[model samples]
Target: MMIDLSRDINLLTKFSIFSKFPLDHLEHLLNCCGAYYKSYEKNEIIYFQGDDINFLCIIISGSISIEKIDIFGNNTYMLDFYSGNFFGEQMILDTPSISPYTYKCSTKCKILCLPFHKKYSTNNCKNTCDCRLLFRENLLNQIAENNLLFINKLEVLSKKNIREKIMTFLINESEKCNSNKVQIPFSKSKFADYLGVNRSALMRVLSNMKNDGLIELNNKTFTILK
Candidate 1:
């Protein structure tokens, strides 16, 4: 699975983390790495809970669900990743016995897998080279973002009931859309998963919101009334 390094480097440069790295460094990494392109059908498992981690996966297109499964086989979702996001970095630092989670394609996905040599030992810490610094900065940014998201979810969940959570999510989404009319980018099931609620609860909340005259919903389209 050979790739044109120049082309891929150019595409990667548009990503926030990789953008900070000089193109030369990315090109160098590309040269040192072997890449493969693969696609997965919707809901397909890209890697299992304890699969051998041999490569880092970068999303080229589409989305993936990162999930963790306990020994009892109960699953909890971690996140949904879109294009330009990388996964499996934890594997780079952990032993084979300490597998963290599984990565599954929520939708059809295209990914670039960069296989690393068993003994590759270049630390991409912030204080190192520009490329390494970029990597560290990006990682820190993701951590901060995730922390904020966690806090927001907690706050929402602490509300009196599901109605409040639904209203809050709608208000936030409306603001993000820059208009009262907003179309949810994901399905109700995905929204339920994100809010840590059941689909029936979400539907009930939406119905309650509509009855309260706070919003109007037509299929996936929602209009928040001021």
Candidate 2:
């Protein structure tokens, strides 16, 4: 679909990778990367596990989920990416790479797709272009940030019980948001998926936690009372 490039570019500039780029250079880089935008409706699958992955994607609006579906068709939520966040980096560099998880839109959204090994990026690695160099550094930073988030999820999963898991996850969220009261991107069911727990059990634990005075819950926002 057609988009207003100026408006779209402005939106992208909010991210550090593109923030320092001059308008002209950014446009050139987009052209060199063969960047394009696509729209998805809520719950639409953007990519499935094992699907060929040829591009990196950034969310322009709305949210996306990285998920794993088991043989029995049960899905586990792995991560959420919101506006200005990107994914598909892990497989983007390999020849004939395949997706490791399913990517689904959590809301009606727009995504920017760019080939991993594009002209601008490739040339920048070999030569000196201030804009491209800055972009590379920012891209690497983004990948590292994703890795840290994965580590945090792993920490949450390491807890043995549902209560411990919930506490760990919420504590991590509190730290990330720098507030005791934190907002979760997922609904109860989706949060259960992320925790790899049954929804009914998750709800029960949350109720118990609330009663124990350990946390105060109001819909998606949880305030750690401890």
Candidate 3:
């Protein structure tokens, strides 16, 4: 669907990347960099691994699951991105790049795509130069933070045991949410894939942990009790 520029620009403002941008500046940027809106159904592929990624994709609603498929057809879950989160920011360089992971809709989704190359090709007016600079700075900061998160993901994957892995992941989530009670973003199967564990084993470990009085589990929310 074609975006109603005026109405959607208001929606874009809700994202932190555009938090500092004035509405007029944002509107000008939107004009300079064409905007596209796309919707997908649950379990639909947004982009396959090795697909060209030429634009920044922001989640306007719902969530996306990122995973990699190996030659043997084994799948490894990488991460989940929710509304206001974006992908392809790292690929928005001078050269074209392919996605390393597949992006699939975890639910019905609405996304906005902005062509970064368009922004580069268009000369910025003096009035919007500050807006361009701010946006670049914001993009860089987001990229750095994303890198840190990948490193943290590596840490989680490095644990020696399933119990350790589960605790490590829950602890990280607790820290991120600043609460002892943390919500698990993915379903049990997806979470197991992320942890590189068998779903049955993961469930058994969680049950044991609860019985050990180490944690309290309530649906998707787990509270660190110990």
Best by lDDT: 3
TM accuracy, model 1? 0.77
**Per-residue alpha-carbon lDDT of model 3 for 123-148, expressed as tens digits?**
54442477777777777777777677
- State model 1's lDDT: 0.71
- The TM-score between candidate 3 and the true structure equals 0.91
C-alpha root-mean-square deviation, each candidate: 3.7, 2.7, 2.2
lDDT of 2 by residue, 103-219 (tens): 999999998887746433565344256555666778888888888988989998999999999999998989888999989988999899889899999999999999999999999
TM-score of each: 0.77, 0.88, 0.91
Backbone clashes (count) for model 2: 0
Higher-lDDT candidate of 1 and 3: 3
* lDDT of every predicted structure (CA atoms): 0.71, 0.82, 0.83
Poorest 10 consecutive residues of model 1 by lDDT?
119-128
Clashes of each: 0, 0, 0
Q: Is candidate 1 or candidate 3 better by TM-score?
A: 3
> Which of 1 and 2 is ahead in lDDT?
2
Stretches off by above 4 angstroms in model 2 are: 69-74, 90-96, 116-128
